[model samples]
Target chain A: MLLDDAVLRAIMRGLHITGSFVLFGNCVLQGWLLPAPVKPWVQARLRVISQGSFAVLFIAGICWFVLQTVDMSGAQDAGDIWQALPVVAGSTRFGGLLIGRLVGFTLAALALWLGWRRGAAVLAGAALAAEGWLGHGGAMPGPVGTLLLGSAVLHLLSGGVWLGSLPGLWVGLRGLDMAQAAVLARRFSPLGVVCVIGLLLSASVQYLILIGSPAALLNSGYGQLALLKMSLLLGLLALAAVNRYHLAPRLPMGDELARRLLLRSVVAEMALGLLAVLAAGQLLQLAPPAMAAMLGQSGG
Target chain B: MKLVNLIALALLLGISPAFAHAFLAKSDPPVGSVVHGAPKMLVLSFTEDLEVPFCRVAVSDSMGMNDAAGKPQAVPGHPNELMVPLNIQMPGKVSVIWHALSVDTHKTQGNFSFTVTP
Candidate 1:
């Protein structure tokens, strides 16, 4: 059945963003979180996640491109450079974004193949970086778009490290040697720290873009939901801190209670993160600036 | 735990307001506004930059026919604004109907009436 345009766009955007999260998250987990003993398993899992998500993203992206092509042909500004390029090259904004995505996708595919062949980590990193650039960061224009793009990059990276590490941790607990698992956890911690920092920076930038003004915090539905997301993230951060400083140390000594608590907390954090993602899906549809302006006028 | 589940449900339900869009901010020659001279063109302004090609603005006299001289043209430099020239030259009450697809693909349509004085 033919879907409504808004619904279709929302689905496309959600698929793209979610696929990105999976791709980056899995990579971070493999590179930083998995211990050396279980590195092979983690690598395999990352490959699975990356390949699966990319397949979905590539298909959805192509569908969106086709739809956009049809729409652009009939566009009133059809003759403009921006509108002509996807069909012509170096023509329009949409064309630029499309080209960026194409380049990024190609790089990512090649990187995946190389990674499977035990390619250099640096090469894989470069491909992933390009993937980030083309997916959301490269699509943005101007200072605001640049800021948004940067945030999107961090969001993908941090989300990858946090969410993507879970399965590996679960597997390590199932059968791996205790000392090896502990060592892995230790190695993963520093990467987690870096990912957290990136997440916070990106999220802050995104918040600034969305909120735009202080009044928006209380005015628009989008703003209110964003505040809720922030609160949830703060709670998640507190839980993460506890996991890192308190629970992680105890795990090496085989403290059952600490392990249980940590597991529960991580699950909760993941659940909250999913909720945040869903909220974000909704927020992207809202008219933040207009709503904020309306609220300002009403308040005055 | 039940309380938490209930709260989550409430939050999910409360999220209905997120489906907002670029509504018609205003229109020049306000809907049904009586004017002295025949408007040379009809103009519409939207709250957000609309995706062109899928948007249209049409004007018709009392008979409910299209009075547009040719295809509607997007206002240059303003993707949100659409203009359609009027072909009629008489003092008659005209109805203006506009429909547009927002960048997000939300379809919106609205209509207004105005009289052109001889």
Candidate 2:
């Protein structure tokens, strides 16, 4: 059988995205949100998570590259991928961009090792932004291409700030006094709002550039997957609203019940965000409806 | 923000959605067309930028003999166009098969034929 499998590629892409979320979230939590002088135990655990996420990104990224090589070269088997690797890596724009992203990831690791939390976050964000070049946004031509790609980068960075930070919040809330927890939650709320606005604006731009018509939005597989992702985003936003408006306000009043509920809500938001990422992975594989319609005309 | 507003205005004004995936847009010989004489080259234009090294365009005569002169190459100024030199001297029907991998890693392929009259 051919080595080019869409399902496997999508799964690998999802894993890569998940890794980006975690690493980026970790950076934001460390540098921007969490108060300095964290408990040693908390710092240790966060460090472990950060390291683990890097490993996932590295492994999944390599696998994605291999799968892309197989798909691009029309390889028939394992051996063919080996022969095609150099040509794919050397001759293609995708290869060049992948190399640049790897370099960015490497810089992120070095920054973290040097205890430069802000630098690490910037590097991680840059790496995630480079992913825009590997998707539909990059394929667009001319000035509109720049617009689409910029929107994609903004969407990803906002997603990393919002969805990726959930774990940090989950971890930081543990064993904290109600007052401290409330303080932390309040600090995170404004960031969430900024991210939500960014996500909305960028998503709107992408929708206009990618789907355009209502018919295509409802009828095409890409559009349907996009809708599913939007649904998950809505779920996440609802859960975030509850945490920020209802539960967080009660935390400073020593409402233990509200604290527990907020934690659960964070968990729910993380789950929905993960599903959204997976949907995004699948969406990348399918052509947008407008392009699909053009393909249909040419019998592609 | 200004850029976004402009793009939104353009889209609202009915600009075509940006394209992805390398779908065959047109070809030099033209799919299923009859030409008076053999063309020196085949030019296949796609809707997106192609990864030239990974792309394949094969042209064969009715007897199943390869008629492509050498390896297919990218047209110098066209990122989406692939050019294959033709070696057909006497042609009844020439078959063309192609597989293209776009820069975004979307794959597409198709086949067509054209008749050449003596």
Candidate 3:
């Protein structure tokens, strides 16, 4: 099947989010979870990952912008798209916000290059937060709109903390000795707990507003995509639980089998996280049941 | 606990309201109604603020000739309302077709008709 604009946009959104998660996730893992006095080699590996992630964000962000401008302008020719580009970038609200986000991304890159990992992460987080405005969360009006935007920001950052950190844990474990690996694992567990709670709570708030009713969850296309995302997250959580409760504890005792299993589980959790992100990317392109109902009403 | 702190933060920001999408809420020269004469302009009220440049309205008489004098413009101080001038001089069934893009980038379009009795 020919990939429609929505499908292409979804793919770009997924890639964009993956980049943000890795950038912000690495920052959190390095700043908060990993034991102080991190090895230079491990930091070097993370730096490479951060740079690669920045590249993904820039490329994917550009693709998403081009697609949205075309869709908004209904431009059928390259010349029309070119003409629309300046108007879109300078005149439209979405374009204005995207320009601001581009600035944020640039600052994040500078911070990363300067070896200010925490500052890079903060800038990345701000860029990700701006995404909430680009989607339905930003379209909402009034005080409730304020709350929805807040929930969107919380959800993205908390998710970044969890899904983004898996690679960090793996890289750290691979390079460190058994004792240090155990310490890293333990330190990460509490952070994971906090993030999971944040994700669930913020998601619930968004669901109530977006889905409107429980029945809609099974009925609407947006709701179905959301359900798929939630299921993927549940799978990730189960693997995480096994890694935390059953595997990490055994690592301290020098159980070779447990260490192997924990590493494998972390990889599996990352896969699930990526799939969940893809589902959410598609979900953003669709109007929720509540909004869809309004869209259905036409003067004709 | 860190979990409690995170949960509390999420709850603090969890308030929600109903959803929104721009749609034609109402229009002057009300749909399918009879107006004594050609109104100076047709006004469309939408449920959300619109991006004026992308919005347009076309008024066509029974012969399919365009009756709209100019492009639609947002009413001053009311971003959700669009006003388009009409060029009709005689009584007939006139159709108004419109396409609008809300400030949020949601696009919606529709058409309606009203009778003109001269």
Candidate 4:
């Protein structure tokens, strides 16, 4: 069967998303850190992580997407999948996006390896952005599908900028002075708020279409996982609030302790972000709430 | 960010594939074909796997008499293949109606007729 072992599929999927998010977050962090008055060594380390991930994640993403082709065609086994791959990828919308993502990720990875950061950044960003073209939105039909795809894309990119950037933000804080740390915090707070707004707006609309009913969240596996992702998002927001109101102001006054505290919080948020990404990977494997109900009622 | 957004939009415009329906891909007694004689089974193949409980196939004679066939079941290890046993004591133009629900929960249905020559 295409995904005979559910656990194996989830693990592969989780690793794929986490890998992509790592690259995305690191790239955004690199942007944030470079403008900071951090030590050369610290900046160099972040650059190394970002560049290396761009390369690693590109290959990983392609393999994962290839394996993921089972989602489009109802291929029951590996042999069936292998036979279906060329035709399915050639014909389907999902295949088209996967191919695009593969090409974009490859070029981005190569550019980064060749020390072309700017080009890599653009290409890598595009690669991640195309994910909306697949997943739940891809399954949906009509103009509603287009709308959902747009929302999902915005949601993912905003997340890439926000949650994906957290690790770098945590690491970048280590090398900054109290004032620079405060300035960095100040710079990120507004951006975080804006991104959060985007996340909330998109999420609410997505919930309406994808979830259909709140009761499904409790009854269905897909719903339960979505709840977990939302919980993690809430935790991240709490940390952001803590940083914005409490730690950020403290940093401008040279509070070394507050800088340390803020770094810890960012790390905590980053951990949560990864968890959310993990859940998201598994979520995509599931049928949406209303659909899951139908599957249960109908599948013999 | 705007460029990224623009690229996604440009790439996705008008590219949505109209799939998700479990349309009939083939059949045992192919649609509208003239069979040599009465068939013992009615088998339908779909574009995707069928939810066995929700998918069913009904065979009937030209006089609209229903076949007391075996309950529809997906051919084991073959998700897209559904087969129904037939009690074809007599046949003229055998009509087959099928309704299939894919695992993803998309529903589709259709019917076709094939002549069973004397």
Best by lDDT: 2
lDDT of 1 by residue, A1-300 (tens): 388654565466556555545555555555555566565664566566567766766776565555455444444454552454355234333444545664565565566566532232333333334434433223333344455555665576566566545545555544355666666667767777877777777776555554555676777776797788788778878877887899878878977777677667767776776666556555654555433334212100
Where model 3 places Cα greater than 4 Å from the true spot, the runs are: A293-296, B1-20, B28-43, B74-81, B85-93, B114-118
lDDT of 3 at B69: 89
State the lDDT of candidate 3 residue by residue for B1-118, as single tens digits. Answer: 4434543554577633355556787889898889997898999987666777778788999989888989897799887789998899678999888888776677878788999989
Off by over 4 Å in 4: A1-4, A36-38, A69-82, A110-119, A296-300, B1-118
Q: Give the CAPRI class of candidate 1.
A: incorrect
Q: TM-score, chain B only, every model?
A: 0.75, 0.88, 0.82, 0.81
* DockQ of each model vs. true complex: 0.06, 0.50, 0.34, 0.07
Q: Residues A13-119, candidate 4, lDDT per residue (tens digit)?
A: 56655656666666655544345456876767767766665555555555665555554445688997897677646655555666777677768667766756567
Residue-level lDDT of model 1, residues B1-44, one tens digit each, is 33234324434554222112345666677666788887777777
Whichever of 1 and 3 has more TM-score, that candidate is 3
- Candidate 1's error at B17, in angstroms? 15
- lDDT (10s digit) by residue, model 2, range A1-300: 453489788878888888887888888788888875577767887888788888888788888889888878778988898999988788998888877787787788778878899999999998998899888768766677777888889899999899888887887776455666778898999999989988988888888888887788899888989898888988888888888889989988899888888888888888899899888888888888877765534323
Interface RMSD (one decimal) of model 2:
2.4
lDDT of each: 0.58, 0.84, 0.81, 0.69
Q: lDDT, candidate 2, residue A91?
A: 91
DockQ score for candidate 4 = 0.07
Worst 10 residues of 4 chain B by lDDT: B14-23
Chain A TM-scores, one per candidate? 0.70, 0.94, 0.94, 0.86
Q: Rank the candidates by DockQ, best first.
A: 2, 3, 4, 1
TM-score list, all predictions: 0.61, 0.91, 0.87, 0.69
For all candidates, what are the clash counts? 6, 0, 0, 3
